[model samples]
Target: MIRLLLVVAALFGATGVMAQDFPNKSITVVVPVPPGGVVDLAGRLAAEALAGELKSSVVVDNKAGASANIGATYVAQAKPDGYTLLASYSLYHEVNPLLFNNLKWRPESFVPIGRVVVTPSVVVVHPSLPVHSLKEFVDYVKKNPGAVSFASQGTGSVAHLGSELLKQDTGIEMVHVPYKGSGPAMQDLVAGRVQFFITAPPAVMGYVQQGRLRALAIAGSERHPMLPEVPTSVEQGFPNFQLNPWVGLFAPADTPDAVVRKLAAALEKGLTQPKAIESAKAAGASVSFQSPQELAKTVAQGRAYWAALVKAANIKIE
Candidate 1:
């Protein structure tokens, strides 16, 4: 029994030393989307900020495909050491598994480190659309039923899901147009090929300000500071119609608790820096930090929420 006790103590001591000496080399953060998108921007910003806090080199790797499964799967299968991490949006954790059938990695395959930023989706209509508000847009869609269409980044993306949720809530029937990426979707929307799109502010804010797309209402609990003039979906008569997209950091499951905590501390500190905050704001996002425990709860809630949304809306990917 004494030998067993001594062995356990030695193991614990080794773990402590490993945690103290964690991340001695450069760390790689994987973003499961193409560059120039919101997720990529967030990952690069976090990596740049975290490098300073951790006193180690940090780089971003974009693995854009299969609705983030490709990159997430890579990270999920990576070593549990504090070197390889995932910086992705909520869809991979909350919606993809529920929407796809043959996923190599499950949501539980990764452990949450913390949230980097949370931004609400904005409802933007092409300048040619004959609507000025959410109520008017709904009425217009109802009147013109199949004539109206909306664009989404991809079939199972948050933008797609958000539009699906809106259709269910408002009983509107509009054609769903899926694009390869947000850039293409935004281009089509601007060209008036699609009537409306509900996407992140950073994706559409410049267009809205430039008089290309008209802002109607934000799909969040409250209005964003960047578009204070626009009202929220709640204020527009759709209570509880908020869909805030969030970016978070994660490591493969079974990572050492001490190492996870250390990384989380660096992340929280790095994300709160003025430069980081400014970068997020410029991207139409807010720097929102949560502890590892809090992030786990958020992920759980998101999974439950999206599962129900997908079921009720009968949302599927083809």
Candidate 2:
């Protein structure tokens, strides 16, 4: 009986050590949005880059629904191994908790790997609208009241909250028009179906450049790199109004320190690659890599900031 017990213990110990050997097989990346979107594109780009660095297959799995809560919750409940990772935007970690009261996992449940880029949302209006700048836009909304309808990516999405933040700051009433995604929202904005849309740069940059939509302001403390001529909401008289929706990588909490460090380093290295830089730029994002500690601090601050806004505005998911 003593000999049998010793053999069983040895087998269990061996199993534990084998489990620690991460990436022995393909790594699965859970992309919490549908295909062809900016989030999906970023995940694919990162996965391909990381796979090349690690010399292993990195598969991107699209798990779309519930504004990313479905995929995020899956990662939160997954085992703390480096094999499974979540490729999500800032909305998943920082903004959703304020909108989604039924979310099963909080921001604290995941471990930060690092960030990819900070994508700034542009405050845009249809070309037909009389407003040219953010101040003029606010004045127009104030004069028109509920006549100005603002299109958003979806209910409780960053675009939605961004518009809400503007409302809170300017004290203007604009009817909320929620679309299935940013693509559709921008479509309506270009067609003048909606007078205004607070959307990400990638979705609206083309139209703004083509004169189909007019970019009134960038939603951040300073001007966006791509739209340097445009002023920020803060500069347009709404001081302290800044919203930057970022994309980040995360592993389940309690992942090995070595694995986390390895992934973070790889991500940092990947950002400097020409392809990564080009892809980010094409998506209207600026590449800014952070270490795990720095990422954690940013995540914490973002959560608190968005949560405070949600509370003050009495915002809720619909």
Candidate 3:
């Protein structure tokens, strides 16, 4: 019994030492989407901020595939030693498990480090759409029914689900066009191949400013700083119409509490830095840091609400 106690004490001591020396080497923040999108931008920003705070090398690895399942599984299977972390969001953390059958990771697979940023989404229409606001868009879609088509980053993405929620709320029918990535979807939307898209400001604000696309409405309670002229969906009377994609940091579950606290503290402090805040805002997101417990609760509540939406929408992925 004494020998067993000694072994346990040594194990705890080692963990303490490891946590104290946490991230002594390079750290990788795995992003589950392709490069060039706002999420990737957020991940890169997080890496830079963390590198400053931790005083070590922090890099991003884009393992984009399978609707964020690839990178999520990779992170889930990574060593719970705080070196291999995930720069992920609602889709990977909360929604994918509901959408993917035989999903390898669960909500518990990740230890929530902290939320990095939250970017409010907006609705943009092609120049030819003839809709200038959310109400007009809804009315036009209802009038056209299956004739009008909408673009999504992918079938299971927040864009897709948010569109579905819009359809359910307003009883509008539009054909769904899912793309391989947000880049392709934006490309087609800009080309008028798809009539509409719902995405972040960084992705669509340039088009809106250039008059290439019409900004219908920001989908949250508050209007975006980048597009202050655009009114929110709530102002248009559809208070339920909202989709803000938030990115958060996570490590594999079973990561030591000491390491988790250290990383979370760095993230919290990093977010307060003027550089981090400005960079995030420049990328069309705001630096909104949530503690692990707060993030965990948000994830759980989001999962529940989204699961019901999925069921009601009868959304399926082949």
Candidate 4:
């Protein structure tokens, strides 16, 4: 019994030492989407901030494909030694499994380190569209019926699901146009190919300011500070129209609790920095942090909500 106790003490000591020296080398943050989008920008910003906090090199790896399954799978299968991490939104973890059938990794494949930021979706219309407020847009869509089209980042993206919820709520029948990415979709919306687009603020706020597009409503619980003139969907009479996409940091499941805590602490510290906060705001995301336990609960609640949404919308992807 004494020998067994000595062995256990030695094991704990070794683990403690490893945790103290955690992330002694460079770390890789995997982004499940292409560079330049909101998620990608958030990942890069997070990498920069985390590098400063850890005093180690942090690189962002863009492995975009298969609706974020590719990069998520890469991180899920990576070594759980605090070296490889995932920087993605809740959609990849909470919504994708409900939408796709071929995903190799499940939500349980990751251990939440911390939540980074939450960005509200904005509803913008092409300049040519003959509508202004959310009420006008809804009325226009109802009148035009199949004459209007809405663009989304992809078939099963948050943008798509949000629009689906809008259609269901307002009883509109606009056609759905799926784009490879938000950039192209916004381009098409600007060119007047699509009538309406629901996307992140960073993607359309500049255009709205330039008068290329008109802001209708923000699909959030409250109005966004950046777009103070635009009211929220709730204020516009759609009380249930809140869709905020949140990005968080994660490591492969089975990562040591000590390592996870260290990383989470670094993330919380980094995200609170003025530079990080400004950078995230420039990307149209508010810097927000949540502990691992809080993030886990958030993910659980989001999974339940999104699962029912997907089922209700009949959103399916092979």
Best by TM-score: 1
Q: Give the TM-score of candidate 3.
A: 0.93
Tens-digit per-residue lDDT, 1-318, candidate 1: 999999999999988999999878999999998887668878987798679888999999999887789999999999998789999798877888997897988889899888998878899999887889999999999998888889988877777888888888889998999998788998999999998898887777788899999999999778898889999999999986789889999999988999999999999988878898998888888899988899999999999988898899888877
> Model 2, poorest ten-residue lDDT window?
14-23
Q: Score candidate 3 by lDDT.
A: 0.88
Q: Report the lDDT tens digits of candidate 2 across residue range 62-169.
A: 998888889999999998878888887987788887777778888888898888787888888988888889889888889989998998877667777888888888
Model 2 accuracy (lDDT, Cα)? 0.82
Error of 3 at 239 (Å): 1.0
Give the Å shift of residue 274 in candidate 2: 1.1
Which residues of candidate 3, in runs, are more than 4 Å off? 1-7
Q: Against the hidden true structure, what lDDT does model 4 obtain?
A: 0.87
Ranking of candidates on TM-score, top first: 1, 3, 4, 2
What local lDDT score does residue 158 receive in model 3, on the 0 to 100 scale? 76
- Residue 286 Cα positional deviation in candidate 3, in Å, after optimal superposition: 1.2
Candidate 1: pairs in clash: none
| Model 1 stretches astray by more than 4 angstroms | none
In candidate 4, list every pair of residues with a backbone clash.
Answer: none
Error of 2 at 307 (Å): 1.4
Error of 3 at 298 (Å): 1.4
As for TM-score, the candidate ahead, 2 or 4, is: 4
